[model samples]
Target chain A: MDPYPPSNELGATLGRIRGLVLTQETAQHAVDLLAQVAQETMPNASGAGVSLIHEAQRTSVGATDALVRTADDLQYDLGEGPCLTAWATRSPVMIEDTTTDQRFSRWSGAAAEAGVRSCFSVPLLRGRDSLGAMKVYSTVPGAFDEADRARLTSLSVAASALLGHVQTSETSTRISSELRESLRSRDLVGIAKGILMQREGLTEAEALAALTARARSTGIPFGQLTADIVNGHGASGRRGAP
Target chain B: MIGFPHAEEQRALINAAVVESGFTVGEVWLHYFSLSGEVDEYEVEAYLTGLMPLPSLECDLLALAVNELIDDLPPRRRAPFSDELIRSHAGSGDAE
Candidate 1:
């Protein structure tokens, strides 16, 4: 048998977590549930939250309470704390006693005053890409032991998987939007090309070249110039004959 | 302060701009690089024609990188720098 007795209800907990991940809930709801799972699974954790880092933006989701949110916000505002460190370095960061942790003294002091005496964070990662981080905080100092770390780390795997799914979905939606935009631009340019081809008696490629040249010479964007042509404005009017 | 230290992150911004600007990635790259003095118009044309055309997204990313590099240059130098880019394009006659 495994030497470490199950600290929480592993089987039931995993089943519920799997339902949360696999169900059709919003990404935020899933993230909140994951935080709840962390708080429930780790006996030392008094509160839990997930910090999402996208490009230059940081947001805290599913903080168990206001104190948990405050603890997270302090780290983001200072740009130093276990959660940010975990996201940056893609490793688990443990602050056994925030008062004595000199690495992030300002944030540590703020967090301590907020009643968070200790914390642990693990990055939600997929290969080299970091999805974000999951942080658990406690009012008692030196709250997390190795067993707690092991438990949270395992939970973070589920967190990463769900977060990765959400990331892919968002990316797809963005790409679809971009594709629509590209097509609209293409349509306008194509019509402009046709108009130029017929009016100026030039080949399709030549008409396109002319439009691009005019866009550059006038400092108007290529799409805008083509749009003007479709609307019978600007360069097409200047050309007089076309 | 505006900073894009990671190349991938910079590329992503460039890709968005390329899509939004409706400029082919190659043209944007040539314009950006010409502005930065990193590559001349002829070199960009040569690279584009001799090799398979770069995907438009990739070209935009490279162009964006050049733009960021130029932004980091001294403000007083920016005007003359853009003037040089215009001059270089005038010299090239749409070779790109």
Candidate 2:
């Protein structure tokens, strides 16, 4: 039997960590570029925005103008808007006229007051997962045509393929915690090895070997076993089994 | 790869246990690294696959890492006896 079978979870986790390391700056750059693409695709759009959301919270955002920023921020702040709905539903959302729209009443009212009369939002979907959403805002009602919608949808597909590999802040936080735990466990093992070395007059290799032997015999987890040794509950002086 | 007496046997036994324990090479290597096992993850993978050989000491450490991870795995759910369940909830709010 192959001792080390292929581990998809480990590979994916490592890939995410590698992505985080490689794309901390690039992720923001990519979003900014995608927002520019959205604006370029629809020249009539007053402004454009792109957001990478995690668990209903925006992790990264890019906007073509202040109007776009305001419109996108209001969605997160009010917890309802075209972009969020597109992301949640994993589909496109169009507001021909925010003033006449009743779906997201609070958002539409506020958006209209903020000078956003129309919007088109498309979810950035990669396979079964929705990464976030991209949107274009227009100051005039019914500004976008069917062709414009189709163009934006195509852009979203390309954007999703790129952004899907980018790591979010959430992943960085998780990696740090995992590293901290690994360090803590390593420290305990070091201390346990030192104790065994001092008490048994053994070299480092022999000390580790002894610890491994003890763990195997007791069927105890190495971390817990080391903690026991460090805390003076180990079989130090006693040679035979308790 | 060095040839010591029973080196292949030791490697085989360690590989068997690691495979049986269902641990990825990365997980085992991380724990082994924590225990001061001096081998990189790639070499460890190679060693486990029998493509390369590790020193006897490193082999033992790998075995320990696998066994510890196996020990740490959450055990199967066990049905509690009626008396055990009662005793667990018998404290009520007294401790608080």
True contacts kept of each: 0.00, 0.55
Q: Who wins the TM-score comparison?
A: 2
Candidate 2 clashing pairs? none
- The true-versus-predicted C-alpha distance at residue A166 of model 1, in Å, is 1.7
DockQ for all models: 0.02, 0.30
lDDT of 1 by residue, A66-184 (tens): 89999988877887888888988899999999889998999999999889999999999987788789989999999999999999999999888887876554333223333345446
Residue A227 error for model 1, in Å? 18
Error of 1 at B45 (Å): 33
* Model 1: reference contacts kept, as a fraction: 0.00
Stretches of candidate 2 off by over 4 Å are A1-23, A168-242, B1-96
DockQ of 1: 0.02
| lDDT of each residue in B6-25, candidate 2, tens digit only | 88888888788888878878
Model 1 CA lDDT for position A81 = 85
